[model samples]
Target: MTTLRLGFARGGLEIKQFLRSRESVVFTLFFPLLLLVIFGSVFDAEIAPGVSFTQYFAAGIIAAGLLTTGFQSLAIQIPMEREKGILKRLRGTPMPRTAYFIGKVIMVLAIGAAETVVLVATAAAFYDLPVPSTAAKWVTFGWVSLLGISACTLCGIAFSSLARTGRGAPAIVTPVALVLQFISGVFFQYTSIPEWMRTIASLFPLKWITQGMRSVFLPDSFAAQEVGGGWQLGYVAIALGAWVIIGLALCVFTFRWTDRG
Candidate 1:
C-alpha cells in the first residue's frame, strides 16, 4: 500500500511535467486528430466497400493515440531521464528501483484512460459512431485497452534501456512507431494492403488493438474480415500476451536505474 501510494505520487509529478510541455500536448492530443483529419477527408467511401472511411478509421486512430501516449512517450522519456542523471540521482535515494518503473506504468495508465475518453468523445461527435451499445462491449473495450496499454508501456521501458541518450531516444522510437503505424493500418484500410503486408500487420500488437477496439464500438456485421474465428478475439489475446511476456523478460534483463549503466 505504501509502495503504491508513493508510486502514484511520483507518477503525478511525471504527468504534471509532461502536461506542461506544449510539444507533449500536441503529441498527446492533436497528432492523432491530424491523422484523423487527413485520412478521414482524403479517403472517401468510394475507396473501400461497406466501410465508412471515418468510422472504420476511428478505431485505429484511437489505438494510435493510446499507443503514442504510453509506449512512445515512455520510450523517449526514460532515456532522457537517464541522460539527465535523474534516474541515477533517484537511485541514490532509498526508493526501490522498481518503484520508479511502477510509477511510470501508473502514469501511463492514467494518461491512457484520459486519451481513451478524448478519442471516444471525438469519434462519437465527428464520426457519428455509436458509443458502446452494450455493457459487454464496454467491458471488452476496457479490458482490451488496458491490456494493450500494459503490454506497450512495458515494451517501451524495455526498449528505452537500449537507447544511449536523450537525443537518440526520439530518433529510435519515432521512426519505429511510424513504421508500425503505417503497416498496422492506422493510416490505411487493411483490405487495401497487399496480402504480405496484411499478414505482417496481423502479427503486430497494434493491429490486434485497433481491431479489438472496433469490435467493441462497431456492430459485428460491420467487421470486414473474420479473424481468429470471430472478430479476432483470439488474436488479440495472443499478440498482447506475447508482447507482455517478451517485454517483462527484456525489462528484467536490461532495465537500469542509473545513467552510468
Candidate 2:
C-alpha cells in the first residue's frame, strides 16, 4: 500500500510537469485536433461511397494521440531526466525504483484514455459519428486501447536509452513516428495504399493499433482489408508481449539512474 501510494504520488508529479509544457500540450492535444480538422474535412464526402469519414478519422486520431503520449513523450523525457540527474537523485530515496516507472505508466495511460475520450466525444458531437453501438465492440476498443498504450510505452522506454540529450530526442522520435504514421494507415486509407506499404505497416504496432480502433468502430467490410485479419486479438497480444520483453531487457541493460556519463 505504501509503495503504491509512493508510485501514485510520483506519477502525479510527473503528470503535473508534463501538463505544464506548452509544446507537449500542443503536440499531444492540438496536433490530433489539427489532423481531425484537415483530414476529416478532406474525407468528409462519403469516403468509399458509404463509409463515414468521422468514424475513420476518430480511430486514426486516437492512435496518433496514443503514440504521442505513450511512445514519443517517453523517448524524449527519459533521456532528459537522466541527463539532468533526476534519475540519480531519485535513486537515493527509500522509494522502490520501480515505483517511478509505475508512476509514468499510470500517468501516460491516463493521458491516453483522456485523449481517446476527447476524440470520440468530439467526433460524435460535431462530426456526426456515433459511438460503438455494441457491447462487444466497446470491449474490443477497451482492450485494444490498453494494448496500444502498453506496447508504445514499452517501445518508448526501450528507445529512450539510445538518446543522449533532450535536444536530439524530438528529432530522433518525431521523424520515425511520422514515418510510421504515414505507413500505418492513420492518415491514409489502407485499401488505397499499395500492397508493399501494407506489408510494411503490418510490421509496426502503430498500424495494428489503428486497425484495432477501426475494427471497433467501422463495419466488418472495412475491417477485413486491414492487416492481421481484422484486429486479431492474438496479434495484439504477440506484438505487445514482444515489445514488453524487449523494453524490459533494454531497461535492465542500459537504463541508468544517474546522469553521470
Candidate 3:
C-alpha cells in the first residue's frame, strides 16, 4: 500500500518533469499528430467504398503513437537517466525497485492515453475519422491499449540496458521502431504489403496492435482487407499477451541500474 502510494507520487513528479521539457512534449505528444496531418492530407483516396484513407491511417497512427510513447520514449529516457546516475541514485534510495517501475508504467500510461486522445480528436476533426461508437468497441480499444502499452514499456526497459551511453540509445532504438512501424502497417495497409513482409510482421506486437486498432475504428467489412481476412481479435490478444509475458521476463533479466551492470 505504501509502495503504491510512493509510486503514484513518483509518477506525478515524472509527469511534471516531462511537461517541463518543450522538446519532449512536442515530439512525444504531438509527433503522431504531425504525421497524421501530413499523411492524412497527402492521401485522399478511399481504401473501401466508404472508408477514406485517412480513416484507415488514423488507426495506424494511434497504434504507432502508443508505440512511440511506451517503447521509444522509455528506451531512450531510461538509458539517458542511467548514464546521468539518476537510476543509480534511485537504486540507492529507500524506494523499492518495483515502485520505481510502477512509476514508469504510470507515466507511460498517462502520456500514451493523452497522445491517443489527441490523435483521435485530430483525426476526427480534420480527417472525418470516426470514433468507436459502441461499448464493445470501446472495451476492445481499452484492452488493446493496455496490453500494447505494457508490452512496449517492458520491452523498452529491457532494451535500454543495451545502450552504454545516452547518445547510443536512439541509435539502437529508433531504427528498430522505424522498421516495425513500416512493416506493421502503420505507414501502409497490411493487406497491400507483400505476403512475406506480412508474415515477418506477424511475429511482432505492433502489427497486432495496429490490427486491433483497425478493428475498433474501421467497419466490419474492412476486416476482409486484413491478412487473415478478419479482425482476428483473439490472435491480437494472444500475440500482445505473449509479448507482455516475454517483455516482463526480459526486463527482469536485462534491466540494470547503471551502465556497469
Candidate 4:
C-alpha cells in the first residue's frame, strides 16, 4: 500500500513535468494532427468502394499517435534519464524499483489518453472519420485502446534495456519503429502491401491495432478490405496479450537499472 502510494505521487510528478516540456507537447500532441492533416489532405477520395482514404488513414494516425506517445517517447526518455544519472540516483535511494516503473506506466497512460482524444478529434474534424457511433463500436474502441496502451508501454520499458546512452536512443528506436509502422500498415493501405510483407507484419501489435481501429470507425462493409475479411478482434486481443506477457518477462529479466552498458 505504501509503495503504491509512493508510485502514485511519483507518477503524478512525472506527468506534470512531461506536460510542461515544450518538446514533449509538440511531439506528443501536435505531431499526429499534422500527419493526419497532411496525408489526409493529399488522399481525399475513398480508397475502397465506400470508405474514403481519409477515413482509412485516420485510424492509422490515431494508432501512430498512441504508439509515439507510449512506445517511442519512453524508449528515448528512459535512456536520457539514465544518462542524466536520474535512474542511477533513484536506484541508490530506498525507493522501490517497482514504484519507479509504475510511475512511468502511469505517465504513459495519461499521455496516451490525452493523445487519443486529440487525435480522434482532429481526425473527425479534418478527415470526416466515421466516429464510433454505436455502442458496440465504442466498446471495441475502449478495449482496443486499453490493450494498445498496455502493450506499447510494456514494449517501451522492455526495449529501453537496449539503450546505452541518451544521445543514440532515437537513432536506435525510431528506425525500428518506423519500419514496423510501414510494414504494419500505419502509414499506408494494408492490402496494398505484398502478401509476404503482410505476413511479416502479422507478428506485431501495430497491425492488429490498426485493424482494431478500423473495425470501430469503418462501416461493416469495410471488413471486406481486411486480411481475413473481418475485424478479427480476437486476434487483436491475443496479440496484444502476448506482447504484454513478453514485455513483463523482458522487463523483469533484462531491464537495465542504469544505462551504463
Best by TM-score: 3
Off by over 4 Å in 3: none
Q: Which stretches of candidate 1 lie over 4 Å from their true place?
A: 46-50, 224-229
Q: Write the per-residue lDDT of candidate 1 for residues 234-258, one digit (tens) a residue.
A: 7788889998898889999998877
Full candidate order by lDDT, most accurate first:
3, 4, 1, 2
Residue-pair clashes, model 1: 0
* Model 1 C-alpha RMSD to native: 1.9
TM-score of each: 0.93, 0.91, 0.98, 0.97
Q: For candidate 3, write residues 98-192 as lDDT tens digits.
A: 88888899999999999999999999889988889999999999999999999999889988988889989999999999999999999988878
Best by lDDT: 3
Clashing pairs in 4: none
Task: Give the per-residue Cα lDDT of candidate 2 at 85.
Answer: 79
What lDDT score goes with residue 144 in model 2?
82
Local accuracy of candidate 4 as per-residue lDDT tens digits, 1-261:
878998998999999999799999898888888888898889888788889988888888787776887789989999888889899899999999989988998998888888889888888876788789999899999999888878888888888879888888999999978887898877888999999999988887888889999998888998987889888899999998898898789878988877555
